[model samples]
Target: MSSSTKPRRGLSALAALAGIIAAGVVLGIAELAGAFFRASATPVIALGSTFIDFTPPWMKDFAIETFGTNDKLALLVGMGITIALLAAVLGIVAFRRWVLGVAGVLLMGAIILASVLTRAGSSLPDALPTIVGTAAGLLALRVLIARLRRTAVGDPAGASTATTAMTAATGGRGATGVTVTEKDDAATGQDGNEREGATAASLPSAGTSRRGFFAAVGVTAVVAAVAAGGGRLLAGARNNIAAVRDSLAFPAPASPAPALPAGVHPPVPGLTPFVTPNDDFYRIDTALSVPQLTADDWVLRVHGMVEEEFELSFRDLLDADLIERHVTLTCVSNPVGGYLAGNAKWLGYPLREVLARARPLDGADMVLSTSSDGFSASTPLPVLQDERDAMLAVAMNGEPLPVEHGFPVRMVVPGLYGYVSATKWVVDLEVTRFADRTAYWTDRGWAEKGPIKTMARVEVPQSFASLEAGTVMIGGTAWSQHRGITKVEVSVDNGDWEEVTLAAEASVDTWRQWSHELSLESGLHTVRSRATDAVDGLQTEERADTVPDGASGWQSVQFTVK
Candidate 1:
């Protein structure tokens, strides 16, 4: 509002900006320190994961639909922006009122601490970084605010006198100011005003404080950048677990899969690949950062409701007799005909054999498997103990499982949706009961038992594709997992359904490829495909949203014939 006050406000604003940078520097240092402990336990990641865990099902679906595989990246970006805005506000508030700023910082620390504590494997030590970082941020805010306060508007009368005295002492102008003071009492008001103005002109200006604040902020920013870069480097160094995975090899399967029969893959263009490649396989999990566990340090513990509790090291798992089989895994969240299903050749020890050793009590009907990162799945004990090829997979598609896909070891149970069966980075299998406990997804409103619904997906003549007006090849893949696909039928424009040529069945646990040909006329056409499973279960034609358990419906695609 006043000419003298404008520069003071500008300086305070700059100081506020400096305070924000200092806060960032403090957090960067905390993250740097945390790299040596547990990298995944950092405040941001822990809080972000907690937020995701509490996210509602519709929002999850919306995110998947909107950002696809980049949904996690989008969430991180949103969190970063939200944090930055709050930090900026805190900085400005601290500059105005230091106590309030400190309270805000502490509140943030409490939130982060609470989030960390609730995490899967977190302990009191995980709160150390956030606590230390908050303290540092509060100190930085106080120091920067103190420095800026020197230029803040104060008692005008006292400030003017202090300024004049400082100028006279520093510039050796005491004589001139003293002489002017000697005449000022008897002089007219105008002359007194003129003398006061002269004194004010000779005093220090606000520009100096502004310049100093900027310099301090610049230095703090550079240091923060260095610390952030160092943290990344340290985290990267811990990623050597990937190299260990590459060098490590699981033992040959004692009961190898049967040899593939000829004509397993249908000779149809645009048909889905019979076996989804490891790299292209769909991954939908709760891991924001992949847990890097070296095989030497990895251990699996089986306990709870078991007559005999046992622990197995990674070496022990590799030494056990293993079996290789092709299994199709599906996500419960996958919509009818979605791409979130993949068939892979898995190599691992049979889950049934391992559970047999544990000897789960009869009362317990579920195995609550948990990942190293804290994600949990409630798998039916009967499904795992049955003659099915449920296993603790060590390798996928002849290679060690990708870190993102779950390295070291993961579970692969056929017939069931991944929400209840495929536990990655698996560490503990607690033989429990469905009545006594629930899993991560189950608590979030998903069904306890997730079975893969029979479905057929069209791979060729995708929705909105333009095809030439002639014989058009309609090809796709159908999957029933435990129940093999018996027949695939295609219907054109609500017309009669016709059976498509089905590929030879490899095993009941994998998907089947099928194709059909159709004579088309120019215009738009809606084509749908459905499959009948070996047990007389037909893929439903009614549409249903993927939730609770799984989706059921015929997958329809519309294309124009040229």
Candidate 2:
């Protein structure tokens, strides 16, 4: 803590920074190596997924509510910042107490190892990259700290007697026989104060060692930056699965949907499009990154509680008799009146026939489907086997599935919420029971069976829209999927409900467009909509948040009439 000891402490601090930077470089190199085999093999991704798995439901909701589809990217950025800060701390600790630093690095590796092991289908080889990266970090820390320790600039005021004697013998020069400063007072016949000042100024300051440490840091940082860029490039190159999907042609559907009526979607401005484009579709899932899978490498394994288990390749799916149907899919996390629902024309084989081939046992009451990235959903066995057109879909809206929407294949069940039914990149289906197993969200406090609730949204006359006073057309979409919307009603300022004209229903599995015209005099007007299902099931009026199951409430929007 002495003034003369400042330079040595400063050098130690620099060494610690260098150590951290070097460790980052080592890990980056390891990440590049892992990318050649699989993108998911990287340490950060494994750790991120583990963090997501353990995150509480409310925190997960908070992230989704805050970042929307970019929540995963936000999580990765947060994790990166956390890791960098921890690494810097470890580097500093290692500079002063190397043993503790080494221990910390090993502990970090152990945590990553545990994360990898906990992942579904993880093998022993999955741990090798993290272990190797951690060992390299430890080595870098050791080398940098050792170089720092060898520097001899600790105390300028207290140069040893040997140092003074050596300086005098060499005529106020360094022991290396080089002139380091002006002559000491002993040689120049000057006072003690002058000699002491000259001695302090002339001492060899560990310049060579400091320069070497800085060079190491610069080179390591540059290399890490290059590695990161290269890793991203390689990953992008590996994601050519989209090209493969585009090249292949979908066969004619054995059972195609009835052509949609022309006026199915009203021309009202701001109304939700009848068919949500593949790119504009809402995506809410636990995957931190999209899985890049080509049809050639895709495979589905059907087993568990079945008389005969079987594996179906992507080619097999293509060859199977495919049907096309229009279905509306909804996310369980969608709040009432949320835009997390979409209607699409899907092409695939009937999921019931696929299960029938496996001959599920009588007691088997659920089908636990899993994605290539290890996400799982448990669909009710009866729902899947029923004549509701539940399917293993391979195409959406006349094109192959988009990579972000599940490239090779996915499950599409009309009535159930996507959390329990629509699984993307689906690879496995284990026939089981709710008592014996659970899906991802189900384990996190959601209902095991997530049925879609009837809901209506006023897309036109969106909140705060300005319009001229007189007749105003209020149009929107209402979906009860499978149950079908029998009647839609609109109300202004919580006034008496008025029935709206319904467009021709595409099918029981798709949403219907409805509209109503109201005469307004002036100022602000609050409009609300509600729907009744085919079975006369009235849409719930009380509002509810999305949790344990789906949300329910009347959709309302306010607007102004000049």
Candidate 3:
């Protein structure tokens, strides 16, 4: 009710609000950091998906209804809830008298505990980060509450500030006032009253406290709002950072398709001069959505069971003494003749460079690569350490990694399937044991160790009933991972094999992008291609589904040529 106290309370509230905002920023940074680390351990390609597997045909259609694959919409789907939870904790803590601050802290702790309880599961790796972050948030509340209490007790008005004017007016106040000397009290009271009135004059003049409660409330509200906004923005920034770094790693291809000399043609009719482009690279992940993240926000943390805990910034990675290598990558999910494999120039610091710096103990057999959206792949450390071009590659063809690919950084292990080797949009590389680790796909019933199955595809038409009498062109692609594709043959239905021309081989780690051209007449045709490796391993005819290991048998295409 006193005029003097209103302005002081207003100013104090503003100060408290500022503190709350700072705290919220810290909370956002923490979540972002966790997301960054979490990503390195897994591929966070999808979030809030109700059905990961066991889907019927209609189920995919229905699930798509809920979690549309348009990444931008998916990224912010649960942001409202995230902001609300963060706000409730911050708002309550920031706008408080001492007791209120304590209550706010307790509230924050309760929220954290509830989140942990709801997230219990080895399957849910994020549960750990969420719990740790929530606990830190609550602890921050406790510190803030204690500070508020101290400030309250230290104030000249003490417990009575809430109703100090009533106490002072009715002459019913106690030692909280300290009753200096009656004469001094009279003079001080007058002085306090005068200052209170002046403060009130500048304030809204509707407040009733000599302390800073009203100002604190206002400031805290503003800070809480600001913090909530920040959390949403930083939540997935690590992936975005990967996108930027990826953009740098693989750039747009230059040098259009080379003009073939007269009568000289590409063995595969559709083959381009250069192999894979970053945008067109095949992507397979559990993340229903590609998280939107940025480069400035990306950070890498290497901790736990390590002699030294290392955290890296984007610049730190770029500035590190670098090594560049070209390696071809393959996917286990690729069918016997699928397009899921490609080879390109890769540039980055070598895995040996980063690992030697970390100095892993003897028992570490796997390096778990995690993504921003919570997807993970367990990779063999020995493979990376051994005679392979394994790299923490930042660049793909010649530019940054593409967002569709692992933008910032991903693992490129030759001769292994992506499930066991390639990890994209990777944020963390935890050195651990296979017995102790399970990746996103592993939990989903995928193979524990995915090896590339040797196979080849027919690129040219061999036997056809639908081809025109005139000559038509036919061609396709083949791969054998690190072993390399050495020889290929195209055969018509029950026809003799014809040798196909191959491209200049780069390395065993790179795919030998090859093709065979054939002239065909209009007819329905059955075409088949078989590849032989450098070790003389022949392409098998045994058919297999993509399960415990890669697929088998030669690739065939049946079509009409006119």
Candidate 4:
């Protein structure tokens, strides 16, 4: 390649690199600044949360189905790639026209600033990190791009001088002093290749500029990494609520859940346990980062459309008469045969009692429960006031609520899908009509009242499994939530359904395990299972997507007998 072309290509690449490096500096500095404020004040977290708030329901369902618990991680990775690509473009543009690059960076900052300031409970101070970070990024970009330009200008001139010195030293002769002619140049394929020789000679001549540019890049990268790592460490130290949670001593419940039956957990391998462990519970929420809140500072305000407004502190909740119940929570986005449902023993005060103290107005039909992170759920007021064990849950199993699940406090209502009922890190309860306000998911085209559908799944003899040819045991768990699963029936390859033995029921609100032993011949076979609820409601056989409400359809798995 010609010396001019080589320098141009290198400069372009360096410019792109400068842009990427500048973006890293921006994020690192922003994160460092955010350490002084709330975690949501960080530009990436704020932007990611905003994106989640505006995402369509279908898209949200797709993400949960595609990535399960790692949806947030996937989103962050996707955002990082997108930002890097855009930054690279901005860098190239800045190299050619500096003003446009500045405009692009400023525009991104504006977007981030808006995301930070518009967050729930956000103040003007929350935008400081974004503002400061953007300024630092701009400065970094300016300095790096300036260095790249200098290199571009210096490389060609240095190459020309080096070529001239080399020609004069060689006296137009080969390295061994052999005479060179146009015919020899043509024969050796060196004809019209003076620029190539100049390009080769430019390597040492341009070493200073290359070294300077690379040194700046290296330093910037190191600083960015240090800033980012230090910021994360600082944030973790500041928001280490885990220590506080672990130190908490929860009072005994006024009413406790009944002792589990002997056969509640059937001796079936691969079947979901009757009580999902705290760590094994399914988590499907919009929180990018778990909100860190201490029990001492937590306060819940109950107001709006009420005869009396009341504020409940964490201490007050702990002192109140709490009840424990084994409740199964389901995500509306859980696909058929999906594992987005879990049962756990929850302990907390009754929501009905809490709302009773406030005396919600007669016309109020919804209770808009909002999280500390600004996510809100519009639940039916009647559901919270009903005879069900719906409560302001504070502890799961025997321990304080896990931070990710919702430390300090969260709502737990049986039967209803989590989107409409469970509001983790709950801070505000506004009683109002559903017509007056829409929740985060409801605004995104999901059903405002998300009641979980009765569904059954086949766990053992998994899909496409090869099994021994004798009597094979088929087992799984089925749930109808508030309406207990009374029977589970299994059918083989479109054959007549046979009743499966149901394990002892834990409660009307928890799922039941079921297993059936059937003799099967060799070859492929599809097993389908369906459940009947206590109210004689049968699990639907028609397939429907998990939109508007929970999914429906009997789950079927195919296996082969060896």
Candidate 5:
């Protein structure tokens, strides 16, 4: 490559590096500023949340299917890559066209500002971080570009003085009678001559400019790293809700769940535990970050179409006659045989009693439950008021609710999908007609009411697992929460279905474990299982995608017998 071409390419790369560094500054400073306000106000969080809000249902399902519980992390990583690529482009653009680059930076800031302001409970103060960070990034970009330009064309004043001195020393001529201008051009490789012959006197200024640009980049990177880390630390320190949750004490339930029956958890290895541990419970929600809240400061407000509006404080909720029940919660996005269902012992006050005190209007048929993060679910009022143990849950599995699961308060309703019934970090409930409102998922085209479907999964020999040719135990769990699993049937290699030994049922609201012993010859095989609910509703054999409602199909796993 030509010497001139190489320098230009190098400078362009430097420009892109400058852009990336500026972007780092932008995010770091914004994060630091957000530490003083709210973490959700940061540009990344706001944008990620906005993206989630606008994502199509199919994309959401794809992400859930692809990433499982780590979907949020996958989204953040994707966002990071996209932003970095865009930032590099912005940097190169600014290096080439200064005004357009500035405009791009401002436009990004405006977008982030809109995202932050549009968040639930957002106020004017939330825009400050975006504004301040954008300004900082713009300034950094301008300064870096200036240094890069200097590197491209060394200090004009210094070059001029040096040229004059050379001309005077050479008497404005060379051995070839060439003009000083021509000699200088040749020396500087302006005419495609040798670059090694470049004047030594002209190198210092260009070298200094390059050095200064690199130094600035290094400093900016360090600042960005420090700011980002410090902001995270500060935010964590400010949100001491986790500590509060850890120190909380719960009163004995006025009505505790019955003792679990023996054999509820069969001896079969790899079977899902009867009671899902709090840490292992499935969490699928739109929250980009978990909402941190202290029980002491938490309050639930009930209003809209009610005879009388009432606010329940955390203290009042704790003092109420609480009830504990074993319930299985399912996500509507859970594909057939997906591990998105879990049974847990929940402690909370009955929602029917709470709503009874509010005295709902005659026409009200739905309760719009909203999370602090602005997610909402439309639950049928009759379901909450019925004999079903729908409750405003405070604790899970005998311990205070984990922050990620909703610490201060969450809603737990058996038999319904979480998209329509289970609301974590719940703060408000509006009694209203289904016609009067659409929830977060409903607005996105999910069904208005999401009843958990009867389903079963194979767990003992996982999909694609290999086992010895002999008698093998096929164990799994089945659920039709609130309807109860009556029987589970397993079939091998599309053979006749046979009844499996069902574990003792815990409650109508919890999943039942089932296992069957089968002999297998050495070969590849597929096992399928289905469940029968208490109402004799057989798990469907037809396949349906998880959308508009829950998924329906028999779960089949293939394994190899050696």
Candidate 6:
């Protein structure tokens, strides 16, 4: 705090900064290495349907169309490179410098906090081990510095070398009786007669410098440990979430796929489309990989704007009445018409049941649903209450929800497009009005209430299609999502609509896939599909893209009658 002390303090600060930079660079390298390991694994193509079953249909569509299950490999590799570059920059900036070093450490910590450090649910508790390790390093550094200062710079024997030389030089009345040469005397050494060390002894400044260096390093370690520890704890505490992920293993052959009504052919060959095999569903989301969380650790908080704050446990939801309903989910990002939607049986407690415990006030219009991983969707409470089967589903197709699918619990609303309905890995349900909040997607320029638009696809080749004049099955899927797909019509290019045989309607929640047999003549042909919903809304033929709202139009497929 004094004038003379300013230089030393500045130097110490510089040394401290260098230490932090060094530590952060080391940590960055470790994280980048982890990224490399992830990149080397085989890309997960279909995360299995169970993992994707409950994801907001819109989110699922986006991942497939944008990242594509396999292209995700590139993103992992790119993030690794970025992290490594950041580390290199930090290392350079920290080269015996303080401000730069501290800055680098802070940057590295932020990257880790926002991305890498949050690998699994409840990241806060698991980060304790890191705190313990960094703390131990600082403690050791401090104690080592104190001991080194005393032994290396403060040793008396080490400091006495100059005193002996001085006594022999000024021998005018020396106790040992050694005569001093006129040319060598400390008293008159100014003109080559006296030596500076002989009279005014001094220790090597190098030793002092080394001692200070160590002391600064020790201080740096202590500060870094505190900073990192505090950050980890704060972040972990703020985002504490756990979702149980059950395994959806391949089914035994005997459990033949669910029987479909007379006409529909499943999307995949050889199996019925209604019963999505657990192993064959699509998975896409921000989580490049799934985090496996345990049931005992899972907690669902229902605490905002509620008369009674209900903290629901996995056991509580599962113990209530179990309902099984089949539903189709679609992603908003699916192309003007895309393949990112699917149908599957989901099992769980009705969402209305959970909200009941919270006892929402009369004004509560929206339930802002959130995940353990910082994603949210504002589902209108009115929708859930009106649809009795809408649930916080835990099981998909008769098995515990798979980890990739939000695992322990997820929201399931029929009729609504995924944008406002399906929220996977759900952790919170803030009972509030629409005016009170905006969800993650809403902030990103999407319509607040993204209802699924009517859509239909053509499956088989008909007349003029170069098919051998024989019976051919023409089938495809149509979805109004929550609104119930009613009539599906197939037509030959610009031909009249012919009613196709429809699959049994599982419920308003499930998609109604339909099929019809067509007799074709040998030639090139164009087939198209269109759907009429229960609300009398017809699938539009206009070309409108997915923007602030969902996509719509007829689905056309070209083929030849061989």
Greater TM-score among 4 and 5 belongs to: 5
Candidate 2 lDDT over residue span 1-562, tens digit each: 8654665456546755856685686568667666665556678878898999888877887776678777888998898788877887877666555567778888888888898777777788877777777777677676665545434332343344334434543455554566645354457687765654564566445566456666766776787778767877887787777679869897898899889978888778778889899888888887766788888889999999999999999889888899999999998877767788888999998999999999999899999999988999999999999989999999999999988888889999999999998899999999998899999888899888888899988888878889999999889999998999999998889899999999888898999998888899999899889999987589989887787788889988889999
Per-candidate TM-scores read 0.86, 0.85, 0.56, 0.91, 0.92, 0.62
In angstroms, give how far residue 184 of model 4 lies from its true place: 38
How many clashes does the backbone of model 2 have? 0
Tens digits of per-residue lDDT, candidate 5, 1-562, equal 7545566667668889999999999999998988998778999999999999999999999999999999999999999999988999998888766777888999999999999999998999999989988988898888887667656545433333323323443466422346756667666657522322354334457778778889989988998889889989999999988789888899999998999988898889888888899989999999997888898779999999999998999899889999999999989988988999888999999999988999999999999999999999999999999999999999999899999998889999999999998999999999999998999999999999888889998898998999999999889999998889999999999999999999999999888999999999999999999999988589889899999798999999999999
> Model 5 segments beyond 4 Å from truth?
154-208
lDDT of 4 by residue, 1-562 (tens): 6655665566667889999999999999999999999889998999999999888888888999999988999999999999999899988877767777899999999999999998888999999999999999999998897666545534654343323323443565433466656687678777435734544454444567778889999999888889999999999999888889878998888998889989997777888888999999999888887898999889999999999998999999989999999999999989899999899999999999998999998899999999999999999999999999999999999999999999989999988999999999999999999989999888888888988899898999889999999899889999998889989999999999999999999888999999889999899999999999988578889999998887999888999999
- Candidate 4 Cα outliers beyond 4 Å, as residue runs: 1-6, 157-204
Regions of candidate 6 where Cα sits further than 4 Å from its true position: 1-63, 80-272, 460-471
Model 2 quality (TM-score): 0.85
| Model 1 lDDT per residue over 1-562, tens place | 6665655455546555855786687667777767776755677787788888889988887787677677889989998778777777787676555567778888888888898788877787887777776676676666665545434323233244334433433352332344434455466555545555554455445556445555666777777677777877898886687689779866778999887778888788776688888888988888887788888878999999999999998888888999999898888777776788888899999999989999988799999999999999999999999999999999999999888888889999999999899999999999999999999999989899988889999889889999999999888888998989999999999999999998889899999988788999999999989999988578888888887788888988999999
Q: In order, what lDDT does every prediction score? A: 0.80, 0.80, 0.56, 0.87, 0.87, 0.58
Deviation of model 5 at 156, angstroms: 13
Instruction: Report the lDDT of model 6 for residue 468.
Output: 61
Q: What lDDT is reached at residue 387 by model 1?
A: 92
Residue 85 in model 2: lDDT: 78
Residue 485, model 3: lDDT of 82
Off by over 4 Å in 2: 1-23, 139-215, 465-471
Q: After superposition, how far is residue 279 of candidate 4 from its true place, in Å?
A: 1.3
lDDT of the structure predicted as candidate 3: 0.56
Q: Which should have the higher TM-score, number 1 or number 6?
A: 1
